[model samples]
Target: MRSGNPVLSDSTFLDLGSGAVLSRPADAMTLNGTIAKTGFLLFLTVLTAAFAWNQSISPAGPTAAAPIYMWGGVIGGLIVAFITIFKKQWSPVTAPLYALLEGFFLGAISAVFAHLYEGIVMQAVMLTFGTLFAMLFAYRSGMIKVTQKFRAGVVAATGGIMLIYLATIGLGFFGINIPYIHESGLIGIGFSLFVVVIAAMNLVLDFDLIETGVSHGAPKYMEWFGGFALLVTLIWLYVEFLRLLAKLQSRD
Candidate 1:
């Protein structure tokens, strides 16, 4: 179940307290929780923006194109990513900012999809929660363990999927269409199924990270970071599910 950094494991830092150093183990779970909660709040802010944007429309449907505010979310997410990866030292502040950006992106994406497929948003939300809870339960019951090999496989698959998606998007700039994407074809459905599995596995990894953090007794700030990671996975899973369901519906 232990992936990532060995230093993060059992790592202790010193706090300068009244000229005396106090040693404390890193509480990653606390950071994770805080990050997750902050991410939710950020998501709410974006949700509100999405709601306002959608409400301003004359026609209420998917045909209504995603606007600038939606793009803002996407751009914000990218910025957050850059900050998180490069400015790792600023995570205490940057992590929360990343969550807020992620929230807006998710909210905007969800709104767009909800408009297209009637009641699909609710379905996706329920499914997301179900998958998350189910995975947590399984992990807690000793039914699942995130082995190094498993983590490697999942990460590789996730990377492949993201690359393909990015390529598809790039192609659109030249007016190229990748046939199966956004289509209700068998290929599209299969891709969705594969991604869904990957996303679900990611949840397992996230849970492992959280448990690892708690066990190591990481600093309280780590809970936010842990939660943030989990939230990202959940959002990704939810969006994928929503798209998959919509494609199936379109085919029907």
Candidate 2:
């Protein structure tokens, strides 16, 4: 099984796919269970996100989101993600924690964006969910096949995007700007669109991975892992949508 999501990559589910049958069928992963857990994680994320967002607002006007939320969320979320990734068995606990941490960071950053560009957060949320359901439908309907070639293409494209982002961040240390790619110009818009498309494609791969795990009778705890993986992709997708919408709105 392969997925563009780093959390659900090739090795993530290899043992299950390699004919390692579970001794207890009742302890195996289930579609319904995965769905339920995903919903719960999403709820926890939104709950904390709303809390953080509310904390950022005031009667005086929008204020800077506290640095604590940004730094704490980013660092805490990353650490929890790494632990969950390396210890898949810990997902049942770490996954929810990951969502909670991410919510604070997402909320803080989103508040900052919403302050600069009114209505952008709502637009981004709508677009994110719209793309999510659309992609899920396309996958379920077999409109998009997860062939080997498709997986390879998405994996390569995702890697390239990561490299470009890393390079951009590294260059920023020396005060070097990536120029048009980060501006409200055509190139920036196009780049964001490409990233959004790739993010959507990764969803298809994530769905495929979830199905594979179910078919292979992966352990029940994998339900949490599967949900965690989906959340990661959704988070990435949402952030990209925010960037894309912000760029589009900046021109107006």
Candidate 3:
């Protein structure tokens, strides 16, 4: 099944090239290794994110620091993420770099939301992880099946959302605002809720895809690649949670 995650769904595993260089048992991807790599990457992300968060909340304020950390992270993270995707073998190094860079962007934006709605970042963080574990539980217990139909539906929805975002950003250059965005209205809240659900569901797809890769005896370095793909979904989920929480808080 094609995963909704861009990195994973790009058919990276399919690049095994007719299995001539199939991984040896001792050098194949494993669940434990992937989990460990993921945890380590998360640690790097949080460490840098804390630093960026502190910077954003400093006397300089978000506006003054936005270009430095925010844009730097955004641009740098994308560059590294693309490099990792195109050169999956380089993931061992690029994955950690991507995480650290992504943290800056996440932290700066989260600080902006926190500034607008007190306690929002903490609440969003909680909800994001809560959804992650909940989805993991559902997946492991077979409560959530990653059927072909389910994967296709998710991919379609995610694609539509990406298009919407692209259009919104494109229009922003012309000073056009999308009505359902940042309005704190019923539509805005509902839209955010939907995106959060989709983001959470992508985790199930990621899990299934990772298991598939391991079973196929993918190279061990794929552990890092898997972790990087997961981080992409998680960062997306967390940002969506922040937006959802902020919208709900604004209604109060």
Candidate 4:
């Protein structure tokens, strides 16, 4: 399906013409692409809305969000995660939903940060996109490669980061604050930098996966799936960049 011509659309996967090729392989890519794009688009829309609202509310008060709005995003993200895990076959639908929910969560969380650090949200977004494009260019220029060793190391580092973050959150339940989590300090800056590196490496994996899907002649929908994965990674990288920049500015 992906061979021959480079028609970039999801409908190309489903041919109704009599005696036409089934193109199952093409369907795979198309499905993935559609899902990824749909999810990411929905997420961006929601995120924009949330960010706008957050900006509007900032002048009125420090903490203006309803608990339900915050909780809705949290619960929704969990639900999307569960659905994606249990029903991989339904990624076309679930993936985009996850993006929407995550957008909500991110927008809300970002709002909270905006309260403490003025103008940080915008700064973070620009940095995030900037980093994403820079990494993409590096990969395309052969400056970066997704080697087996690199993949393994990045995955391991990412897992470690997730664990540490979870631990930090859990500690919060007991009213414990790991020093420098929000403070401007060497440790905090160092941690943020590390996360940024991991996040950038993740883009390598994302690029490799997309190329693989395309090489295998995956269906048009696969673009959506591919886009979704990249979007998620970019969002994460952007937030970390935002936090790091904020910390640096606070220190100055």
Model 1: per-residue Cα lDDT over 119-143, one tens digit each: 8878998998899889879887989
Clashing pairs in 2: none
lDDT score for candidate 4 against the true structure: 0.65
Model 4 per-residue lDDT tens digits across residues 24-49: 66354643454457456655647654
- Regions of candidate 3 where Cα sits further than 4 Å from its true position: 15-23, 59-63
Q: TM-score-based ranking, best first?
A: 3, 2, 1, 4
Query: TM-score for each prediction?
Result: 0.78, 0.94, 0.95, 0.78
Instruction: Please list the residue runs of candidate 2 whose C-alpha ends up more than 4 Å from where it truly belongs after superposition.
Output: 14-23, 59-64
Q: 3 or 4, which is superior by lDDT? A: 3
**Residue-level lDDT tens digits of model 3 in 1-252:** 688888886466654556443468897888999999999999999988988888887543466675588889999999999999889999999999999999899888877887788899899899989998999999999999988899999999898888889999899999998897657899999899889888988999999999988887788889999999999999999999888888899899
Q: Clashes in candidate 1: how many?
A: 24
The list of candidate 1 runs beyond 4 A from truth reads 1-59, 62-66
Separate clash counts for every candidate: 24, 0, 0, 24
Candidate ranking (lDDT, best to worst): 3, 2, 4, 1
